[model samples]
Target chain A: MKQPIGIFDSGVGGLTVYKAIKRAFPAENIIYFGDTARVPYGPKSENTIIEYSIQNARFLLQKDIKILVVACNTSSAVALQELEKLTDIPIIGVIKPGSKLATDSTHNNHIGVIGTEGTIRSEAYNKAIKSILPEAEIFSCACPLFVPLVEEGWLNHPVSRIVAEEYLNFFKDKEIDTLVLGCTHYPLLKSLIDEIMEHKVKLIDSADAIALHLKTLLPVESSTEPVMDRFYVSDNEAKFSQIAEYILGVQPTPIKRVRLYESWFE
Target chain B: MKQPIGIFDSGVGGLTVYKAIKRAFPAENIIYFGDTARVPYGPKSENTIIEYSIQNARFLLQKDIKILVVACNTSSAVALQELEKLTDIPIIGVIKPGSKLATDSTHNNHIGVIGTEGTIRSEAYNKAIKSILPEAEIFSCACPLFVPLVEEGWLNHPVSRIVAEEYLNFFKDKEIDTLVLGCTHYPLLKSLIDEIMEHKVKLIDSADAIALHLKTLLPVESSTEPVMDRFYVSDNEAKFSQIAEYILGVQPTPIKRVRLYESWFE
Candidate 1:
């Protein structure tokens, strides 16, 4: 039995990571769980995030998964270390791959990072980039509105452009050649962000980078079997299904509503 | 011993409700809990909101309260029925008082309601308005971005104006003489919303309405005592403290961080 790869995020944003993995390995069975009930982990405390991350990992682990992907930047920044101790399976977080890519893309060693407040506060991207290029000047800003805007499906809306400009204009004077789309929901705003930055900055999308990183660590077993990815969320499935369609441009696999642990009421 | 009034919201937006209660009965001791960890219950499903509302009420009930205020519009819209069954204490929700005030303020029986997706979708305000004025014309719009924009501290920013126009423009032709600030957080945007409606719409803030309704039901026990309100949150205190100060225009009482229930890990 080929154990499937497990991916989890606070919400649907992780579907971007799922899409990349699917493209990279077409036949691999996959399980995706979105903690939609307690989402936007961006503004939550470190301890709370760690606890939620552990619960999410435990939920996915029960399915006998081969590998785990921490698709959420906030979780990757703060919970990745704790998650490593939780399980022995190869755990991949978006931070490291994203950092390496940002460093590789920046010719001037000046890079800007934008994400949720929790992720930016964690300084995971800052440290990761500095570790590779000690002299790298990393400018980080917390774009809290970006997630809601994307979730609101205002991807290319004029207001999104205004919000992107409000958040990304900080990079203009910094002369950063590369900017890391530090949150999973951020890539959906790539075009707007690109327009704001005048297409001068190379946007580091961790999805493809994570896919590349995962391929080396776990070689895909050549399989002719068709892909059947499982989707689950802690809260409403309708919103998730609708957003998933908007993001992936196709109706997602039937999504199951789940409780991370025993129902609190029960 | 005077039993304190227990008030709870999904997050700090409920502070507006707390302010109203405080002003109405300066001597009444009050307990306010912001479920910051699992906040913005606006986008969550009905079942999840009900479960969370129950947990919040349970947290407040342990304090031996005289009355309970479901300060969050989403909770009041969906969870008030369940909350009443949980406790016999006189329970007050922002919806009915707000509806009553909106109905009274409108001469033409035309009213508009703006709130989070969950609250607007529940149509509590619409139902409440119609119950009083069957001939009333109601217009409701889910202003999901309003909460994030407020939390981002863009209360009167140009971006807020643009976003307000985007959401409220739907009601332009509806000719609503009164608009219910359906979500608790909305009062923060009252000025901007007023401008978008060209000040023609009378904004009905549920906080003041809820205060008046509470007065008739639970008469204030006249006593001269300094107010020492207890504030608690399920997650980080820093963000809540800062935002509370911004909303209330005074340093909030020292806030305690707590888990609504037994820790899932423990």
Candidate 2:
């Protein structure tokens, strides 16, 4: 199938996922959308999050995509099932794969999950980890500042380290062998988080796990054709391009802006 | 004369202005709307900011308000002129009043402004300050992290202090005498910011200036009546009430949740 694979996020955090996808399936054409105008979906109510997520997915579907990946943890945790009902295309979200990977990697039966308020509040990872290992202890904290810190391009800055230490203090008393970067943006802060958590904890980014999971499902011949990547955003194409370069080490070109108004839905 | 005065913010930052209004005109009835579901209007495109502002004003106007205050700086910077045309009621925004106060407060004619990306990029304050004092030097930076830090309720937390220092580093050598708290939420961090600036600079809080300016335009008889204040938000009324209590030292009661979609707009 030549149809492009559609990927969507609240913003540039999903470029990490896009990078992973590109690494695994270099020949697969991709269409990505970052809702930059309305970034940081964590603070919004569930109804608004799901509404915006739906609008984003519809915007991507208009481009004729084969698979749609909900790269935003907020959407994955809260909007995945609703999105499944909206489209017949094969759909996926980061939470399930991330949870599965975290569950598998944990040896001490203690797992820590960190994400935005929306994701942690939904308890998507907590429930997912609990289902696989009923006796496991899942410690979760909503690290809302991480998103802003990452966006500020302060990945290695002392301020980011201070914020990370403050946020990760929740895990100091708990004995956890593994941590899930429940929010996509957290991966960018991996080194700092590693410094704070020390070397004992394994950090699960979920991007690689997700790419591998999708690989097993796609037809063997799907990768035979040369792939092309296109980027789209609701607003601020230049900023998105800059962020993409920071996250993926390559600027996303030919980016177009699309409007996701109520009329787009009805 | 019995109609309530209207105030609208993208979120609780506007409450600073609301508190000022209450202190100055305790007898005047007031209605305030906080778009908590879609806050930090700082990053959204101008068209979206304008559309949302109009919807918020329209929602407030239905209550028969005497004045419409765009308590949000982003809306004030970008949507003020357009809002005046939306209705016959006298419209006011925080930027002009704050700029006027900053101009009046500055001794060396050098001013520094810190706000969300939307506000700083709009140059609303820079232009406003220059119009009255053309030779005034303006230094502006977008502290996008501050809003999230404040929302995380870390006003005086060490993390907030670190972020403030990092963001304010740009002004260290500029030798500005007065600094404007361009975003309303910023007032909550005044003490911490004051500490960072080493108590040398005068902090200009626009809420007080806007309230004082509005006093000149209001009728002398308006304060004779008993005051009644009501709060409304698109979502998370409880959260808004909590923030109001934190910032205003009074929990807003009789807060109603209202939807501001096209249906409400119509």
Best by DockQ: 1
Segments in model 2 whose C-alpha atoms lie over 4 Å from true places: A222-226, A262-266, B222-228, B260-266
Report the error of model 1 at residue B167, Å. Answer: 1.5
Interface RMSD of predicted model 1: 5.4
Candidate 1, residues B33-58, lDDT tens digits: the string is: 99898989999999989988988898
DockQ of each candidate's interface versus the true one? 0.44, 0.36
Candidate 1: give the clashing pairs.
none
Fnat per model, in the order shown: 0.42, 0.28
TM-score of chain B of 2: 0.95
* Top model number, lDDT: 1
Give the clash count for each candidate: 0, 0
lDDT of 2 by residue, B128-154 (tens): 999999999999988888898889998
| Candidate 1 CAPRI grade | acceptable
**Stretches of candidate 1 above 4 Å error?**
A225-227, A260-266, B224-227, B260-266
**A155-240 per-residue lDDT for model 2 (tens digits):** 89988888788889999989999999988889999989998998889999968768977987785344556667888887778888
Using all chains and alpha carbons, the TM-scores for the candidates as numbered come to 0.96, 0.93
